[model samples]
Target: MINEVILDDFSLKVTSFEQGVSTSSSGTEAKTIRFDFEVRGGTEYHDVTVHLYKNTFDVKVPELDLSFRGTINNYSTSRTDFTNENSSSLFRLELIEIG
Candidate 1:
């Protein structure tokens, strides 16, 4: 089964964009539009949590696919990397960006 990562209330800001050590004031030169914040939810009860980074892939619309990176529990601390662990559970969380 394929999982989808949803981007709700998504907004990106271009703080700076440089090419070959030169900054471009024009919007065309903007290379990085940071998705500083986002909200994610799961459809399954045991969907766990979703952790995001630049390396992660984006999910399609309508369905929000979530991927979490961390300890399942402090006592158990089982490390897992799954695309579809708990697809039936529904969960939501906020993603905040701090510079």
Candidate 2:
């Protein structure tokens, strides 16, 4: 289903996001999102943020998470590319692990 998502014009609207966690102590979990979009000229990789919510289902999280936005540029398909907008010195981005 994720492979079906497309990026439009190197720009994508983040629909939904979540931090992947594991119950086992030996495993390491991080934040991720259900990034979806389709763009002409391919989507540009950029530094985006995953806002951590204090209260579940809180709308105010967006504003609070603005500061914690991380730079993670993952392209599910070849249609996406890196651009100036998303090229930040803070974080580096790479391709998603697809199997």
Candidate 3:
């Protein structure tokens, strides 16, 4: 099973991970990487999204020996408020290849 993902400087332990390809209008295919993980607490949530949003990342899957430069094609979280220390939510991130 795909367990972990490295995005930029963050090493995230994922609950699920997938690699895919998408064909554009020009008929060129590009790699698409997606994963699901959990984020807990307000501080942790902020820490994770602060530098990642709207930025290109060096994505890596060490076990599969795959790496690419990509940006966040999609990002979603289960909860918007994580002020409670015990708060936790699932996060899904999808990265699309640059070229």
Best candidate per TM-score, number?
3
Candidate 3: how many backbone clashes?
A: 0
A best-first ranking of the candidates according to their TM-score comes to 3, 2, 1
lDDT (tens digit, per residue) of candidate 1 on 1-99: 113324333222212211121134552321111112212233321222333323232322232223222111111112333345342221222222111
The CA lDDT of each predicted structure is 0.25, 0.29, 0.88
**Candidate 1, residue 93: how far the Cα is off, in Å:** 1.4
List model 2 lDDT by residue over 3-74, tens digit each: 221121122333333334223355544333344432233132322222211111111123224112233334
Candidate 3 weakest lDDT stretch, 10 residues: 46-55
TM-score list, all predictions: 0.18, 0.28, 0.93
**Candidate order by lDDT, highest to lowest?**
3, 2, 1
Candidate 3 RMSD to the real structure: 1.1
TM-score of 1: 0.18
Off by over 4 Å in 2: 1-11, 15-19, 22-25, 42-74, 78-99
Lowest-lDDT window of 10 residues in candidate 2?
51-60
Alpha carbon deviation, residue 32, candidate 1 (Å): 18
Per-residue lDDT of candidate 3, residues 26-49 (tens digit) = 999889998999999878888888
Candidate 2, TM-score vs. the true structure? 0.28
